[model samples]
Target: GESVGLHLPTLSVQEGDNSIINCAYSNSASDYFIWYKQESGKGPQFIIDIRSNMDKRQGQRVTVLLNKTVKHLSLQIAATQPGDSAVYFCAETPGGGGNKLTFGTGTQLKVEL
Candidate 1:
């Protein structure tokens, strides 16, 4: 399985820094991509997304870079904060049919004061 799973249950970082989250995908044919952030106990909220047609996409305070050449993707969060602490998950939509999201490994983000 090419699914991405988190190796760590939590990550603690200082505020006003940067955060980098990693994920692994399974399907080699997946085309669409998305990064979601979930608060303490809330549903994942859409942060940013990119299509297979592009290599990178940027949003306010966040940037997603895709390396189709290596079948890898990463999320970069700028200015870490206590409120920024949450679980992040990456999702991909495999090509071929209806747009369905396949989730990858999740990383727990914790911002320390």
Candidate 2:
């Protein structure tokens, strides 16, 4: 049985500081990973993604890191802002089949002024 979970339920960071959200997946076969951000009433928005073949991928203001050795994934946000306040989720597709995505419980990101 494969499952995904977050290390922390909530993460608070000061505005302009860097924020790191961590997730652990039980499926070592999972090859694709995605990070999503969901606001108050909006659907989860794609933030960044990485593949097992790569150790790290960077997007506009975010970065996704994959550690296959430890079956760990992480999302990092640079210059955290109030707008970045939201629930962040990490998802992974088992075996890279892209058939389904198993999402974590999600971590609340709070950006303090």
Which numbered prediction scores highest in lDDT against the true structure?
2
Q: List the residue pairs that clash in candidate 1.
A: 2-26, 4-105, 5-105
The per-prediction CA RMSD against the true structure, in angstroms, equals 1.6, 1.0
Q: List the residue pairs that clash in candidate 2.
A: none
Compared with the true structure, model 2 gives a TM-score of 0.96
Model 1, CA-based lDDT: 0.83
**Worst ten in a row by lDDT for model 1:** 1-10
Candidate 1 positional error at 79, Å = 0.8
Per-candidate total of colliding backbone pairs: 3, 0
TM-score of decoy 1 = 0.90
- Which lDDT tens digits does candidate 1 get at residues 1-113? 65654445677788998888876676789888899998876999999999988988999989999888777788888998788888999899888889778886688999989
Worst 10 residues of 2 by lDDT: 92-101
Give the distance in Å from residue 56's predicted Cα in candidate 2 to where it truly belongs. 0.6
Candidate 1: list runs displaced more than 4 Å.
6-9
